[model samples]
Target: MSAARLASASAATAHQRQWFADLHQEVAAGGDLALVNADAPQEIFRAMGIPYVVNQWWSSIVTAKRRAQDYLGLLRERGYPDDSEQYSSIPLASAFDPDPANAPWGGLPRPTIVLAETTGDASRKIFDIWDTQPGVSFYPLESAAENDVPARWWELMPRDWERAVGSDRLDLMTGELEGLIRFLEQTTGRVFSETRFAEVMDLVNEQQEWNRRTRDLIARARPCPLPVNDSIPSVMIPQWHRGTTWARDAARAFHDEVAERVSTGAAVCSEERARLMWIGRGLWFDLDFYRRFEQSHGAVFVWSMYLAIAADGYLRYGGDPLRALAARFAAFSDQLYTPPWSAEWYVKEARHHGVDGVVHLVSEDARGSYFTTRALEAAGIPVLELHADNVDARSADGDALTRTVGDWLDRRVRAGD
Candidate 1:
């Protein structure tokens, strides 16, 4: 890796680790903790003054710590497929890890509530394990694949989402969120306040607005001021804290850092030649992969959905705050997975960032990459489809992958194929 990480990223990492420590202490003292899916309506948890762990987020930490394979073995012992959605499954398996001394974040505090949307095939089953655990309540929201795919969802999602994604879909999600609120009320003995939810929505919109500015800045900045490695945490950590004052400030701070770096002519690779876009889930276990090609090939990964999706995907501005929040999560995960939606956005982003090539990680659970790959190629961008799990390092050979990408860049991008 390059020594080019952003300050906001460093602060965010320290804050989250310490925050997790504090959260573990809270749960030990009999406080409530929820384990939620990335696409679940987190703003609701925020409004309820609850601290939660995102399943995939913690799984990344475990995978990075090199303990994922051990936990996967435990899952296999329970007859769960070792290769099945390892990213989301690792945390669940950790509950049965037997060796708590080796688990991530002191072995993810036994969640009081388990929350997830049945977006992928394995999600419901994964959360079910949490539900069956003593005292953990599981709330599974429904995710649908809408046939009516709209163009320019980034603009429509913020306000006209009901029509953009269909009113029926929004209606289902909004009702489910209402049920979630009632569940929280009954479980926590705390009144779910509309006032707090609205305020939280305001904070989220403010955060996304800052993200939009940062994305636009980087999209246009020639020499790409920061590495995608740094941008991932800079944008994503705040994303997990969407409705907080600190998250809002962090967004602004990151945007300012990117702006300052660009103004000062800073560069991740001063000899930047090829700009690339990552078109699937982040390579969490090997984020250093993004920088590996920088010195060797001058191929810099300028865009990943983490920052761009946060820029384009999270805003919703219509009626009731609760409904708007529901609208945000209703198609949240799908926007990056379903056809037309995922393909269109990737196409738009590749063009916007002036990418020379694409490394599309086609995870088994992530749908629509076939079309995504075709669309990018049709738009005259060369793409290398790397079939592997973003979370599981064992799924692909890291050294081989670097060579594959380097060869692709040299043969296709450098030769203008």
Candidate 2:
């Protein structure tokens, strides 16, 4: 049976749509806009009153609208590799989509400044191409390697962040953030207010606190009150707007809604025989894939990295908001995609949620997927690894994937039940 959609998710979606439309109009009226990577320090933008659209967020919108293939094809025609980091490359390709009328949401407005971290060789090159466009400047932040591996990082991340993320990495990132502020101040002719930045950081921490409570509430609920599809949008839309009171309130509303559902003994699947976790980027092209197994296998995907990371990954409680923000992102990639850290957190979350099985989507661009799989299996949880691109639909075979996962549930997951 289909689960009731969360009202908070619907409201967040509607707000985002209106917000984007207004942003597009403002930019079209000659206002400057920044296009930043998902990992970039968006709080700085929020505090400075600069409008920015996250590259990955827009890429998901383009992919979900069935426009990824056309944009990806444009990349191939221009001698760029179509197979390179599709999540970042899709928006770059969309910039050249000649027909604005056919573009998703009338296409992303030409950004005045593009900001991204040099996460890898391919992603750096992708952002570099954006710089080549007229009136667009690209700023790259250095991604430092994680030297100190901490156990149970989520526990220490909120208050004891200096020890959780090594001091050396934090220092480097703090310097990078300072440089970014200087650059933005020069480009936009807008002053960077330390007071405003601190306020934004406080709001973001508050938003995540509500998310943490909601996550714990859902984990303890039987039969799962919310599906991953609903949770992803509910958490992520507000997450993109993190550092604002609106986002903070939206997060609390989501928590209250989930808490209410749990109190009422609501269930996504009436006969949920299996509680499963989805590891890796969302299946943006086919969200329906999440619900395919609900009827036959009585399995509902209750966990995804979207809400879990929002709960555990973004909190930093310290006096120095700038340094705390730096600490939050210093090894952000490592905490989610590195060996021991990624593996440990996955095992912890799997146990916390009482997950019986995991479907890990091993994307080509993401690192350390195998370690997460091994850790979950070591914890006595079965895992089904699906190798595919999260945003690119051309690489996914939906029907085949459905059959494969169905067979897996029958053989590996529900068989034990």
Candidate 3:
């Protein structure tokens, strides 16, 4: 590693340790919250002394097999050692195959959550799990896009709205939040006000804005090497989901850091690097394999899915919680689950950004199976369809994925030569 490469790695390691300790202390101090997405909430819990683990974060590490000093370090820092000899060839190899319908790992704390963006019957699936457990709770943020929700909430489309909100759970989904506000006010001697609500909204908006700026930074980090650039996703994912002003600051620092790194032409220690973009949900486990493509075929992964969403998906709700959240969820089906999403458009955009190939981490039981691989292939991009659950480790077909990826690389490597 060059001095710069080595410094980036060392700085990342130091940041990883200090940040984890900082967050753990934050979690040790608890606060009541209505969770959204199993991720953001669990991040709070993990920080607040609540037992939590990101299966996505964990799976990424185990697949990587990178030398982690401690297990908690792996949990806190997103990089895992990518030591799996089998996953050396794929674009972004995942070690996990998740069943999104349930917690990918057994023994997860009972969830309290709101589903904002996901594939298939995501709301129903998450609600069912929460319903079966006690002491764990949740509420729904209406399903819609951030920019479009205020116009059509309370008037959901018949084509998909009714199914998305059924009779049995609709009341629970819609009413629980209002109920919680009232309950907290009455029981805890807490005074609820529009001002307080606005405060929360402000916090959320700040998070969204920062996330957007982060993605914009990465997309600009074009042709940057993988390992050096990988820190962006690892840091941003944890920061956005968890509530930590310090973490947010760290993220901002990261954006400026990457911009500086890219401007300076710093990258992981590699000579020939093929830049690729990852689409769809992150393959929680196979993160290392993704990095290996940089070394194996000289291909550097430039992007993953959620980092971009945080940048683009969050809405600035201002003072209207329902309208803002509803807007975020409104497009979930379209962008991820439902059809008519421009897979072709995104792939073309990636190609324009100079992507050499694409990887779609297909999870088990995720409903949108109709989105074909040909969209990117048609755009003159080689698509690698790796079968793996994005969350759960048990479902991953490591051997099959390894073999298929090897085959894909054989073609790409030979063609490049």
Candidate 4:
């Protein structure tokens, strides 16, 4: 490419990164809230009138592909890409910036409690000070907590502001459904009946069916034997935030659409961008730090985090209400925790997704990361570990991360030496 054109491209990438930086700063105004997932809605929070974002379908899709382009294409096709001043990223998908200080959208939230699939010890420390403290958070489907649930049930159980988080402990459950029904009915003044119950049952069933179908896609999602950048978003978005029906449908929708996009020959990315997969929470403080590697090394990140769950996880919930709920949680723990299983599962996913290498983020509050990291290395896939918070943007040193990632990619993906 000519120097002028190269300079122009650099300028564009810089503009995009700056826009994201502004978006991050602008959104921080809202404060925070308790984050939840499909299987574990915060009944108490809802009851107490605290708001939370369910990350069911969204989480799955982001992890589906091996590149950032895959995600970007999925969004553009879906008509939700970044434009002028708008962002279609997960955090802002459901809501937007106004004056985040007063609302939950733009600004973070007070007590931004989040529901993760499974958090490791270090990751937990990261979550405590970051995801939970300001707010209380838990994993609705944290099946590992099963032995204790019957005794404790799910409650705020505040020890210190960040105690539970520091220990990487998660408050997981399907939520207090029995109590939630009463709360919602009272709050919305809408009467729920067997018919309504059945509707919910139907919703859950649709979710599971979609999940079954999407996994079929995940198995074959990597057509290139090397995943493309545009594919990850469509796969992850829907599955990460599955509780809401709309979230699930959108993810599944992105998959078929992306395939057609390929068939129709849409530009996958501007320069055949060599892609990479990020296997961990997003570094909230340094999204650009994450992307800066592109400019420093001429690589366009095609994928990272959330979006695939939207595509697949949505399928496990749709049958017999209680039965579907149990099945979904059963499926989550069946895969996420328990080292041998989780590590093996991701290996298959990595091979199937076809990435050149893997970058795993190990947080202070996160547990079980070593197992996953080890498994990938044993499988012969190049992997890099970066320690930082996925949410606490405040914790990351963008310049340092950028340098490390640039060197890794130069040798691993670009030079292929």
**What's each prediction's TM-score?**
0.97, 0.98, 0.64, 0.56
Tens-digit lDDT track for model 1 on 238-279?
A: 888889999999999999999999898889998899999988
Best by lDDT: 2
lDDT of all predictions: 0.87, 0.90, 0.46, 0.44
lDDT of 4: 0.44
lDDT tens string, model 2, 1-417? 335999999999999999998988999899999999888889999999999999999988988887788989999999999987998899898778899666888789999999998988999999899999999999888999766688899999999999988888888999989999999999999999999999999999999999999999988989699888999889999999999999999999999999888888788999999999999887888888999988888999999998999999999997588899988888788878998998999999999999889999988776998888988898899999998998888777999899989999999998867
What lDDT, from 0 to 1, does candidate 2 have?
0.90
Q: Model 4: per-residue lDDT, tens digit, 1-417? A: 111112222333344345335545543665334556444533233334344544533322222222223433443554653221111133332232334343222233333445444333433332343333323433322435332221111111111212211222222232434444454455435454645455544554455455445444434432321132333333333333334455446544554554454454443233434546577655443444544554455454334434333333323323335333333344344244446545765676666556677888876545578998888889887888997755433345767777788788887767754
Give the runs in model 3 whose Cα sits over 4 Å from its true position. 1-129, 132-134, 138-180, 183-192, 225-229, 232-244, 317-322, 342-345, 397-400, 412-416
Per-residue CA lDDT of candidate 3, range 277-390, in tens? 666565545555665655567666676655555554443343245334333344544444433343633553475457777766665444344454666666677778766655
Which candidate model has the greater TM-score, 1 or 2? 2
User: After superposition, which runs of candidate 2 have C-alpha atoms over 4 Å from their true positions?
Assistant: none
**lDDT: worst 10-residue window of model 1:** 1-10
Model 3 poorest ten-residue lDDT run: 88-97
Q: Which whole-number lDDT from 0 to 100 does residue 53 have in model 1?
A: 89
What is the lDDT for 363 in model 2? 83
